[model samples]
Target: MGTLSGNLQRPVIAASAVCIASISSDFRDKFWPNKSSDTCSSLEQANSFSLPNSLNEPKSSWVSKISVSKLSNLSFVTRIRIPVPDINNLIPVSRSSSVSSFLYSSLTSSHALINAYQSAELVKAAKPASYTYDVSSTPSEVLYRWHLPDPKSIDVTGSSDCSSVKSRTVVVLLGWLGAKQKHLNRYAEWYTSRGYHAITFTFPMSKILSYQVGGKAEQDIQLLVNHLADWLEEDGKNLVFHTFSNTGWLTYGVILEKLQRSDSSLMGRIRGCIVDSAPVAAPDPQVWASGFSAAFLKKNSVATKGVTSEQSATIKEGNKTTVEAKPELTETALLVILKKFFEVVLNIPTVNRRLSDVLGLLTSQQPSCPQLYIYSSADRVIPAGSVESFIDGQRRNGREVRACNFISTPHVDHFRNDPKLYSSQLTQFLDYCVLTCCTSS
Candidate 1:
């Protein structure tokens, strides 16, 4: 129920010919545990409505039991009054015609829990005192300007060769959802310091939600990759990926899909990849829900050691006593309920929708590049076993795979927990990739 409430907060216009789709009874039980008659009546009414020409619009297989009139322009949102069965009337949202569609598309979600990271504390803390980078954007891509260090900074007098220092490599860093610029810059700095050009991209909450509902975000991803490919080809630069969380993994999975099917020689430009805390083949439904809630509430801050303790302290900020703050009122409870909805209720099917299952498709189609998997057993999101299994599979496929298992690092916080080990392993991996993989076909 909380999940539904969170998603519905934004103003969404209901078509004049509204038709209620079939929702699972189990979903109702979980969403509205109170078992109210008004809710059921609302569901019934919603499912019964049928409009003329409602069949013309595309219908999701899961939602095909009922027919709804298609809006003229799905992208155009407006204010409308709609009767919600058990709840109060939905307030109509108003926006100016002058506002750009892109901005509206990106900021549509009004869920506080999901958008909490918009003002995350970590972003402020991670901000560098000084930095320099050029920024560019296309309809589907955002590119940050970066450059290699001067070759004169390093000693080539006694070295056999210095072309590696002179040659520029592109490091694509895809940050997790709600990740702030400051947080990502910290990671990009590592590459830039070592004469590698770093380009960072962040997955916004609105964009991620599109993927959840099987929207056309994949096409946008292709556009972004095409933009990068053009640049890499023009400059003759090797490519490396540093990805954080499932957002990055899913984006890369799509890239791999295109690579395997197309005859584009661009695939050969990818030298290696370092995946950090991602590619969850199968996630625990409850944990998946909780992980999203926690990430959103915390504003995309990577969980670290003592985070649980920190949360326990913050949950007591209100005047409510520990007893008054019952378990049912906690974030965990809200997420468990939401999990039931995402996994069981509105499980819309889409082409290549393998996210809910295993990532074997991704691993199998993975480009023959050196791969490094970094994870921790303490991560509440990606399971350590899944990471290991992926590594084992890659090895079996005659691919070079490396693993850096931090004993207690939290999700996406391996670097924060142990900087030395993280840096050493990553630098070594890149060095090896540069020496062998980058020079290959």
Candidate 2:
């Protein structure tokens, strides 16, 4: 009991010291302005206060200083009053009060002043890390974030220190299934810093599922394509595609198909493309199943998975255990065998079937634009061999294609495996594309 009491008192002592130091700084700054530089320096060094471990709670305060009276009179007093909850009301600072109540009240009052300063500091820290805006699309809303290039960096006309600023390119990122906004925001920060407006979105798998087996165009894909096409027509912004995983590839396929069909100026606006761990020509059914399980079952909680209406009804009928068992399939070798069954017996096309057609179109097309393909040799989902083959085909068709192959990097995780290399390579790819686009323009 004595040790605990001593431990508790330590925080009170430290907070009292902080309160004194804060008051001392106020006195020095206000009353001792005429003091010598050496004196002020010494006072500052003396005013530095260390905090105790227990009272290191997040600092919060509404006010820092309150002047009750001017210093001209002895009755005049200037003091910093921090707002803390009334212990009488909250904890009842009396004999009947519990130990927890006393502890809470003591800790609260002790850190009241410092907490105010720290709370203000915390609010400053909590300010938006970056500026972002969102735009809604058909089927589901697409979140669009703008990373405007630094005006000072581009203001070459005013500053002699400025180098030539190339035209800003708008990067469109199509993220994989189940990607959150914060996940893509990190990618956006990279582009914004390097002078690119990055527009990012995720494809709705429910809508993706509505499309036919042969990568057929459905209303969902058409709606997204139309939305993008309209945006393209509004401005002649040089557009670049940064695709992640097979899901992104599927969306890209739909976009390319829409661009090909529409009379809009979108195709010409497309300057370059960068595919990350995608364009899998022939995806294994087991791998696709594993990816789906990871996205729907393992990653999401049961309440939040947004299971289909039919699946939800089925769950009500007592097949919940069977549904729960899907994630377990994520571990078993039987998934590979099941992939063959789904493909051969059920005659179901892999999700990449439609995307593979788009890959073919990219390869066989005239004036094949510069493209950067990033893949890993050890990706379990999208085989590196498929990406290599696609690149080889593109090369044969006289397309300018570059491939960054990493050894043993997992699917859609090359960035996490080595962020420096990933970022540098992406910057290089963007630079090359910018130069080519400028020259072509």
Candidate 3:
């Protein structure tokens, strides 16, 4: 029985020696291609002739004391055998040698090889693919839509020179709270029709309610800022910001802050700013409540409805009869509750700090570009008093300012209430900006 066992072991040892030699050769080729294949062949020859002194030592002593550099000088340790089941025949057992373990520990201890592998992985992970916003595709998770003008259908409203100027302009439309891509698309199309690239940005209500100082919303805004910076790198292209409500105004402030920090030169590319129904300097709880209520209730909100009066009058024009009554925002039970809720929420240390930081940037860090404020006295969400005060402050700071108060329109409803007047204001401002930009260049 002992002789039979010895004969079986001899054959197994011989096969193991051959397998170890092949594995060592493969490992050398993979990690150290410069190393000669003769090293592994010598290991196999030494294993067949005489085993190393380390094989006679205890497993713990050799494993603990072995160094990677010493591996090339030593032969295989043949005494250790780990039994592994053969996949083809379950009843039979195969022996795996200690050479694999030695090779693995040696590779792991090699700092240069490990660091090179890690660096390659990091580079592979760090590089982002180039992304261009395609208007034809569905909007991405960023919750913004980009529209490029069509060359064939460009509306040359005036001279050929004006058309050429408009072709190089971009209109950035920042939407109000709870506004969607669909809602902003109307405004976007208005610009696209005039041969201007349009980018409409809106924040989701979920992101607003769960707002954090440097959270997902800020990350998304950073992406837009980066894109804008890249866009400005092209020659002859400029931007016009058309902001709606306090939400849009605050977003614009954030964009301005980012641009100022990254590349202040890009801020010079902004030719004009069209502020619509916005710019409440500080964080007012009531204004926030009103804006949020209008967002939640939409058309049904008291903010959207006009006060009724017994004195109804109609004016007769050449072909149109105009109603004189104007919509007014009134306080309601829901509004009272929302106001109180926001009073507490807005005062939270983090929330207050974040809002104050943005407000500070808006007040002190505006670009030296032409600004147009189109607002309404009857806006329920943003108080006319606040808008006028902010406008006065900007004018006092020596900024080129223009303002038009749509006396009867609701918040951000100037365009929908009277398209002709709104369109006229936009057209004049865009033309002036383009002409000014061209003249300056």
Every model's TM-score? 0.60, 0.54, 0.63
- Candidate 1 per-residue lDDT, tens place, 71-149, comes to 1111111122222111112112235442233222322221111112111211122221122232212223232324333
Candidate number of the best lDDT: 3
Highest TM-score scorer: 3
lDDT ranking from best candidate downward = 3, 1, 2
Q: Is candidate 1 or candidate 3 better by TM-score?
A: 3
Error of 1 at 277 (Å): 0.8
lDDT (Cα) of model 2:
0.52
lDDT of 1: 0.52
RMSD of 3: 22.9
lDDT score of residue 192 within candidate 3: 73
- Name the regions of candidate 3 deviating beyond 4 angstroms: 1-142, 152-159, 306-331, 437-441
Residue lDDT tens for model 3, 1-441:
223234456655676588667765554333333334332223222222211334334463233344433221111111222121111111111233554454334323332121222212211222211111232111122356656564444533334555556666778999999898878888987887776778888887756765667877898788678656655655766889999999999999889989998998998999999999998999888999889888988987767754222211111112112433322444476688888978877887777888889899888778888899998665667877788899999989998889987766778888988899999998888767766544455
